[model samples]
Target: MSQVSLVAARIAALQQAGSALALLQATQELASCADASAAPVLVEVLGFNNPGAAVAAVKGLISLGPAAVEALLQLDPVNYGARAWAVRALAGIGDVRGLELLLDALGSDVAASVRRAAAKGLGQLQLDELPPDQKQDVQGQCLGALLAATSDGEWVVRYAVAVGLELLAAGLPAGSPERQQAQQGLLTLQEAADGTPPVVQRRAKLALSRLELQ
Candidate 1:
């Protein structure tokens, strides 16, 4: 059968699945197809209560890359679970189109997991693909968000902030102001004595060490 026909059949099977196991199997099959045409259906699967199916859909969307951005952006804002999954997919894809969403999620989302994903996504964004001026601007914005997230109450989120700062700094030119700022952010995390978790402190120390080597 043609690829389109097969994708359609897989989508039909996913939609018709009556049991959780069946849904996961169908979702996995559709996701493995990696057809851009399946993006919308894959996105819809994010809203399902099935974590396995959602994970498969996220992988499928990541494979679709920029083509999946629109559908991910169109997800219902009220569906926090779906939007969280979309954030992960967007982060994995690293498309610049999801920049604003990632920024917002990192800065304000109530879920630590979502915030952590967004922090990492901001660092992982494909800024090198943009013109020099635009890349600088976006990088600055990403740096600002990540630095601000360093104070997150959750140790896990703060750990992610350390990672994000390191990655963002690696993309910046050495001796640049943004790079300095990222390094300072890492130092603050590493030196914090206000009950910072040992893991977070170690992560920041490790990130700072890596940045020094770059």
Candidate 2:
């Protein structure tokens, strides 16, 4: 089949609620085609309203290695939501180049959702696994960003920042100051957790438990 047709077919399958693993495979295949023309299709499918589809798309893009970065980068933060998921996939792929991109997005992006995704991506990147000094730097950067976001007028932004902080704490050393600080942030989030979405609340709880602070 032609590249265009193949790409369209895959996207249609995704929209039809195809298997997550299959969609992920197609995402990588489409990304590897190196055809920017297929970007819109991939983005549309990747940005499915369903979180499951979104997660699969990100995983697929990550599997494409570096070639998917440019396509992933071109997605609009507000309209697509792919930018946020892209950061996650990139980080999961273990590419540190995404580190700078994620930081920039979290610090400057207008969309709270995107910024939240970036923050969570940083945690998934295992920034805490870096050398102590490097880990400190990354943690400091995220903390500063989260602090600012928490003060934003948007409740969603506040919640997102809280989630990011909680995730960051997961990999910290036992009884470390950073872990303690993150636990405090999670506690601050607890009061409003009931009002937030169940998934968000669950994530906060998981992160808190990971730190043994629950």
Candidate 3:
């Protein structure tokens, strides 16, 4: 078989294996792929018709760590869900450079789910246990991204953004600038509560509680 055909066969077998665990392992092997020719095929596995396969593939790609970031991001925009998963997986690896890709994803993605995943990943990355100097700028940028998404035309996007902010704000000090900014953002959200959907209102309220309790 030609190298391309061989790689495709492996990917097909991995999909046929069907378990999340098996697919996860296949993703790992795919990530180790040395042939640039196989890269796109690896990404396609991430979009298996099966959600389990897709999730496993994403987990595997992420396990590749920083090395996989650029390739994952370069996938077609039609595959935004896969790309969003890649952003989360990158964050899981504790790499902040992925933050830029996350921000860009939020800004340009029309899909609420993808944007939300990026937002959530950004928040988790904030609590990465990095040193203050390293975490500060990214945290600020995360807050900004969440804020921008809060006003997104879609309720799902707004709710996701609020949830991201709340997760990132957890346990911040009463007098901290972060807490203050969160409170301000909540106030802005509250002012628009009448128009906000039930889900988003719930998220906004949760964020408010976290900030005020601080």
Q: Number of the top candidate by lDDT?
A: 1
List runs of model 3 lying over 4 Å from the truth. 1-44, 47-52, 60-81, 91-94, 126-129, 171-173, 192-194
TM-score of each: 0.97, 0.57, 0.68
lDDT of 1 by residue, 1-214 (tens): 9998999999999999999999999999999998888999999999998999999899889989999999999999999899999999998899999999999999889999999999888988987779999999999999999988888899899988988888889999999989999999999999966978889889999998888888
Clash number by candidate, in order: 0, 0, 0
* Model 2: per-residue Cα lDDT over 1-214, one tens digit each: 9877877775665556467666666666555565545555655665755576576556556656656566666666676465666666665554445777777877777777677667666665555347779878877766666655555555566566666776677666768887777777776665454355555556566667766743
Model 1 residue-pair collision total: 0
Error of 3 at 78 (Å): 8.6
Kindly provide the TM-score of model 1 when superposed on the true structure, using C-alpha atoms: 0.97
Ordered from best to worst TM-score, the candidate numbers read 1, 3, 2
Clashing pairs in 2: none
lDDT of 3 by residue, 85-193 (tens): 6655655554676787788877887677777677777666634577776677667888888777777777776776777777677735567798678667766666655
List pairs with backbone clashes in candidate 3.
none
